[model samples]
Target: MPHTNPASPILQLRGAQVAYGQIQAVKGVDLDLFAGELVSLIGANGAGKTTTLNAIAGTLQLSGGSMSYGGDSIAGLPAHKRLRAGIALVPEGRGIFTRLTVEENLRMGAYTRKDKAEIEADMQRVYELLPRVKERLQQVAGTLSGGEQQMVAIGRALLSRPKLLLLDEPSMGLAPLIVEKIFEVIHTVMKQGVTVLLVEQNANLALGYSNRAYVMDGGKITISGSGQELLHDPKVREAYLGEIA
Candidate 1:
């Protein structure tokens, strides 16, 4: 079930904007992510999807508007601070350290944590969740296939034990079967109580997996609805689903 807590939102952004000098990538966006719900933000290239996620992840500063997490303003918090506050981002292109072993990369995820025993336990849990990761613990991250690298990236993020997981393009550049496996792992994570904000180009898959979704165009959100509603919407079908009608 989707998170029904009416008292507070896990993450909220109002009038959120980001500009790179004269180029405004994300312009005056308003969004809310509730606990225990999988939300997708979908759009074509240059539609500001990545910019919005970067703002939420604290990698980019917002030029306008307010952002809050768990009802407290976190506008000035650094990226590491946000991680400590239970927000973890699995960035696009699987940004794992190519030189590091899978085990070493996973350990990097818990760098901010001081609980040795708990971190160890979490590592074991991740291994169980992704058996392929466990089998290649000593392998260099760069040596793995695209799908394996993705698995390691996700497992590393899970070690942080985040309340909200920001996934940017997990399905990019993978074979169809690989994409399905990645989505399956994501679904498992969601069921395990991680609120996910997924940014995907695969509209059909994103809408199918998410509870609710937002459509972006020209740096602004143009549509918002339940996943099923958007999936069947005529405009969405034409623009995102590649329907001729």
Candidate 2:
């Protein structure tokens, strides 16, 4: 486990609200993420975890409240601008370009950077982190297995050199072994000074791997506590946790 300071949060949200036309998905959710930490958001279907992450990544506009990154307001910034500001999101379903080769997909991740030397360096770094991706460099993304595709998605996100990585369900549609591998990569990313905000359906995996976790339901955050605390909560045990009688 990495040393996590109890003080200082890297990103903070205050009374954040979001909507899609007439459908309001989030209702004044508050969250805090610190540097070099892995925080998780776990809840059942329609819990609004994805909506919250989309708000932070600027993929969706916030209807009310404020979002600050590294102590600066970025509410007016667009998604690409947010990417330049050191934020990257690996959305759900491993949003990889199926038509592209694995290596080409990685290249697309660094499209924002023009420095050839740095871009190549990042490619090598990602390959080192996920050696399987190296073997499939020439393979088409759509042809790869579900787990392999997820690795490519994560590697692509890392190419952005983000300070904050917003991942929505890195463990979806894969075997337990594959899920473990994904978590290992996420741990490695945190060590590289890239904070991770994970939204996962697997409550057990999320709580076990994160320092702290939050639970969302009915368009609101209902619980926020240390990972172990939430994992041990009576209600959490019955609902999200699985050690029931």
Candidate 3:
């Protein structure tokens, strides 16, 4: 059986807006990511999907409203400070350090931690989850295949031992097989008790993995519902689910 909770949200964005220069990429979106749930965000290319993730990660300031994590307002916190507050971002485009070795990238993820022993333990656990990363620990990131690079990116994020993991387009530019593998790894991570906020252009995969999903378009969220519910909605079928009939 699936899990259910009536508790407060672990992460909440209330009436948030994200702007770029003169363009408002995200307009007044409200969302809650509960503990032990995977919340997927899906939309078209320019629909502000990445912008919302950026806002939540503190890369982009909210033009309005507030963001809270675990009941503490994080609206004013910087990106690094948010990480220390237990938020980790596996950014879009698989933003790994191409020139650095895989082990070096993993070590960089632990930069904010002062507890050396715990960091080491988490690193080992990350390797256990991604044995492929362990094999390429000393290999330079630039030399790894695209799928391997994705693994490294996710492993690096997990090394931080964050309470909330933000994944933006984690399935982008990968083969179908690799995409399935990545989703499986995400499930494994969630099973270990981390909350997830997933943003993906591949709506089917995102909705399938998430317990609940939010659908965005033209800088606003137009719909929100259970993953399976959205998957079967007629409007969603015509729009994101890719059904013409």
Best by lDDT: 1
- Please give, for residues 1-245, the per-residue lDDT of candidate 2 as tens digits: 43467776778899999988888889899888888888999998998899999888888878999999988988968889999999999988989999999999999899899889998999999999999999999988999999999999999999989999999999999999999999999988987788999999899888888888889988888998888888778888788876674
lDDT of 1 by residue, 1-245 (tens): 23355767789999999999999999999899989889999989999999999888899889999999999998988899999999999999989899999999999999889999999999999988899999999999999999999999999999889999999999999999989989989999999999999999999999999888999999899999888889999999999998988
- 10 residues in a row with least lDDT, candidate 2: 1-10
RMSD of 2: 1.5
Candidates ranked by TM-score: 1, 3, 2
User: Which stretches of model 3 miss by more than 4 angstroms?
Assistant: 1-3
Candidate lDDT scores, in order, read 0.92, 0.90, 0.90
What's the residue-level lDDT of 159 in candidate 2? Answer: 92
Candidate 1 colliding pairs: none
Local lDDT at 5 for model 3: 70
**Residues 144-219 of candidate 3: C-alpha lDDT, one tens digit per residue:** 9988999999999887889999999999999999999999999889888999999988898888888889999998
Name every residue pair that clashes in candidate 3: none
